[model samples]
Target: MAMNRIADTTNAVEVHGVVKHYGETKALDGVDLAVPQGTVMGVLGPNGAGKTTLVRVLSTLIRPDAGSAFVAGYDVLRQPRQLRRVIGLTGQYASVDEALSGRENLYMIGRLLDLSRRAARLRADELLERFSLTEAAGRAAKGYSGGMRRRLDLAASMIGAPRVLYLDEPTTGLDPRTRNEVWDEVQRMVGDGTTVLLTTQYMEEAENLAESVTVIDRGRVIAGGSIAELKAKVGGRTLHVRPVVVAELPSMAQALDEYGVHGATADQAAGLLSVPIADDGQLTSVVRALGAGGFGIAHMDTHLPSLDEVFLAVTGQRAGGTDPTDPTDPADPTDPAGTKIEEFAA
Candidate 1:
C-alpha cells in the first residue's frame, strides 16, 4: 500500500491558506479546502504538488510555514498534541511491529493511548475481529500477508476512535480483492461518524469513494468541486463535428461560437471542430445552427469528459505521467484510441 485509502468516507477537514516551504521550493502555496463531514475529500495532484507535504502537515507530523489547519475541531499547528488524539493516521506502509503478534501490537498502541491493560486487551481483540484479523491475531506481523498487516495497521489507528482519519494512498500495490477488503474497513469507519481525508492520484479510486475533490498543482489549487463540476469546466458533454466541405469550417465555428458554445477547439487538419455543450439539447442547437448555415455535416459525436481530461485541462499533466513512482500507469489517457468512453451522442 502507498499510504492508506478511505472508503465512502463522510465529513470535512479544512485547510486555509496553508503554506509550506522547503529551502527555496514552496511545497504548499495559499491552498484552501473544505471537506464536509461524512464525505470523502479526495486531494488529487501530481508529484511535487505538495500532496504528501499537506498530508504531513495535517497529520501533525510537521508544522506549516503559514496558515492554519483544523481536523475535527483541533488546530493542527497550535494544538497538535490535542489534534493527534482526535485523528488516526495510516500511512502507505503498515506501521505495526513486525517482531510482535498482531494482538500484541494493537494492545501496545491501545496502552500508549492510555487504555488499561484489560481494556487494551479487549480493544485489541475487538479490532482484530472487526478487521477479520482475529484468526491471525496471535501470529507475528512478519508472518502476516500484505493485507493482514494493513488491517492490523488500520486497527491500531482506531485505538483512539478518532473523529477524523487520514489515509495516504492506502492501497498502492495490493491486489484488487485485498484492496476491496481494506475499502470495506474504511466504509465502516465512516459509518460510525469518522471524517476522512485521502490523498491519491488514482482516478478510479477517487471516483469510487469521493463525493467531491480538490485538485492541486504546483502547491496551489487548480480546481475544486464534485467530479461533475470539474468536468463541466472542460465541457461536461462535448460535441464534435466535421464538415465534409472545408469551406464550412469558418461558418460552423462561427455559428457554434455565436450560439454561445464555450471554448471550441479546432483541428483543421482533420476538418474537425469540437465544443463543450451543457447537454444534449445544446447538441441539437448546434446541429440546427449548422443546418441553417447550409453546411453538410460529415459526422458528429458527443462524449462525456474523462477524468484524465480534467487533470490535463487544469494541471497540464496526464494522469499517468505525473506519478513518478510509476510513470507507466496504464490508467492514462494517451492510448491510441484514447480512453474507452461511452458515446453520449451519435
Candidate 2:
C-alpha cells in the first residue's frame, strides 16, 4: 500500500445533471456525483434509486439522455474509448467464468485489456497474490467459495490497472466475514491511490466503506453528506424507558422534560417511553426525575439512531434494497451489456 503507486487525479469521476429514461420510467433524474482522487464515494439507495443506472452511465455502458459525466478526466460520451482504458468495472455479480481457473480468468482479462502474453500472465499472477488467490489460482472458479470468487472477479477488473473503479454492490451475496474481506481490498485499493465509486443498498456497507455518501431515492438525490452529518438529521442520543406501569408513561415524560430531556414520546401499547437526551448528564437527571415521580422502570437503554432509522426518517421507507420490480429500474444485474471491447493481449 505505497502512496507512490497512486495516480493523482483531483476529481476522478464527475457528473452533472445526468438524466436517463427507460420508456416512461426515469432511472436517473438529473443526478450529480463527484468522486475525488484516491477516495471512496458511496452511492446509497434502495433498488430503483438509479444507483445502477448512474454507474452504467459513468462506466460508458449507457449514455445519459441528458447531462454529462467524466471519469479520469475523459468525457464519458466523447472519450468513452479512452475512459474505458483508465477505468474498471465490477458488477453486482462475480462475472468471472466459472469454468476457468482464477489465474486463467485474470489472465484472460489482462489479455483482453491488450497486455502482451507475458505481461498478462505476470499481471494475473500479481493480482492473484494480491487478492489472496495464489494458492487456488489454478483451481476452477466454480469450486471457489463465494468470497474467493468475488475476490477473483474484483482482481479481473484490476487486470488493466484501472485508475478509477466502479463497484456495484461488490459484496451482494457474501456473508459478513467475506464482505469484510472485500471491504479490506477496497480500502487497500484506495490507499494505493485508486478512486472508487461504490454502489450499495446496505446502510452498514455505506457507513463502513464510504468517505462520503450520496443518497438517491426513486432516481433523485435527496441527501448527500458524510455519515455523521446524515445521522445528525435524525437528532442525537435517545433514551428509551419501559415503565413498570404503562399508565405512568405520561407522568414520566413530563418528569423527563423537567430534567431537560427533549422530545419525550410515549408508547402505551408497548408501555415504553423514549426521550432524546442530550448527554449522560441529561440521562441521569431523567432517571432521577422518573424515580422522584414514583415511576418504576422495567428497563432502559440509550442508543443513537441507526442508519435504517435515518433512511426511514428521510425517505419514509426501509433500506432493505430497491426492489428491481419497481416501475422505475436502474438496470438488470447492475451490468448493462456493452460492445465496447477490450482488445485481447497479442
Candidate 3:
C-alpha cells in the first residue's frame, strides 16, 4: 500500500498574529503558526512560554485577544463550533471519568459527539481493541495503570474520528517506557492521516514524532522550522565519548578542549563526557587524538544537535525546570488574578 501523505498545504491549520493578554501580561505575544494537514507539528518551549495557552487558543477552549486562527478551514474565532467538530484535544492529565468503565467512558464521549447507541458501542469496542484495552474495557478507569489510562484517554479523543488532534504534553509524567508507547501511538495516528499538534517539553519526543517544530519562549516564537533546520541553528554535530574508567575523565576533557571543541563537560552521573564539534570532520581527529593520548574509550557516538540544546540556546534555561502543565511567569509580568485566569485558560 502506498504511504499516506503527512500534510498538504491546501488543507491545514493556520494562525496569524495571535496574541492573548491579561492586564500587563502578554501570554501570547503575536504568535503565528501553520500546521499542514495530516502532519505533526511539535510546539517546544519552557514554562511560561505560552505553549499551553497557544494550544488552548487553537483548540477553541480560549479565545485570543487579537489575531485569528483556522482549523480544517474553519475560523477559530467565528466558527468555533464547526472547528470543534473536526478537532480533538487530550491534555496532560487523563480526562476520563474514573468512576466509569473504560468502555463507558468511550461510549459517553461517542454519545456526546452524536453517535447513535449502537454506533457508540461499536466505536468503543473498536477503540478498546486498538488501544490494547480490551481486557480492561469493563474495569473502571480509576483502577487502570498510568499507561492504560493514557491510552484510554487517547481512545476517547478518537471517538469522533476527528481529523485534527491537539495533544498538550500528553506524556508528561509517564515513565520512559510508557512515554515511548504513547509516541508509537502518535506515529500510528499520523500514519493514518490524522493531523497532530503536539506540545511537549521532552526534546526526544519532539525529535521522534515531529516533522517540524516551533520553539516558543516567553510567550513568543523564537524559532520555527524542520528539526534539521532547528538543529542547524544550534551549529554542528556533537562528539560524545565515554571512557572506560572514571579516572580517564580529566584526560578526555582535556583532549576535547585541545581539538577546539569547548563546553566539554563530564557527566559523572552518566559516566560520559561530551563536547560540541563544528563538523563531522572533527570526529576522526578527535578519535585519533584520544587514542594517541592513551585514553581508552569504552564507547563513542557522534549525534546531531538535539532539541534540548536548541531549547537551552534559545530560552537561556534548561528543560527540566520548565513545567508546561503549570506555567508561571517568574518575571511577574501580570498580576495575581490575571495569572490565575491565564492558568485556567490553559
Q: Which candidate is the best by lDDT?
A: 3
TM-score of each: 0.68, 0.75, 0.79
Ranking by TM-score, best first? 3, 2, 1
Candidate with more favorable, higher TM-score: 1 or 3? 3
What are the Cα lDDT values of the candidates?
0.77, 0.81, 0.81
Off by over 4 Å in 3: 1-11, 236-250, 253-272, 277-288, 296-308, 315-346
| Tens digit of per-residue lDDT, candidate 2, span 1-346 | 2232225657888899999999987888999888888889999876666888999999899989999998877888998888888888899988899999999999888888999999999999999999999999999999999999989988998888788999998998899999999999998888888899999877778778898888886578867888777766656667889988899888888877777666899999888898886666887788788888888899999876654455555543222355656643322223221210011101
Question: Residue 335 in model 1: shift from native, Å?
Answer: 18
Q: Model 3, range 228-332, lDDT digits (tens) per residue?
A: 877766666677788889777877788867876567888888888887777667777778778878888888887755544665454433333454455543322
In model 1, the worst 10-residue window by lDDT is 337-346
Query: Whose TM-score is greatest here?
Result: 3
Q: List the residue pairs that clash in candidate 2.
A: 46-322, 47-321, 47-322, 111-345
lDDT of 1 by residue, 16-134 (tens): 99999999877888889888887778887655667888889999899999998877656787777777777888988898899999999999999999999999999999999999998
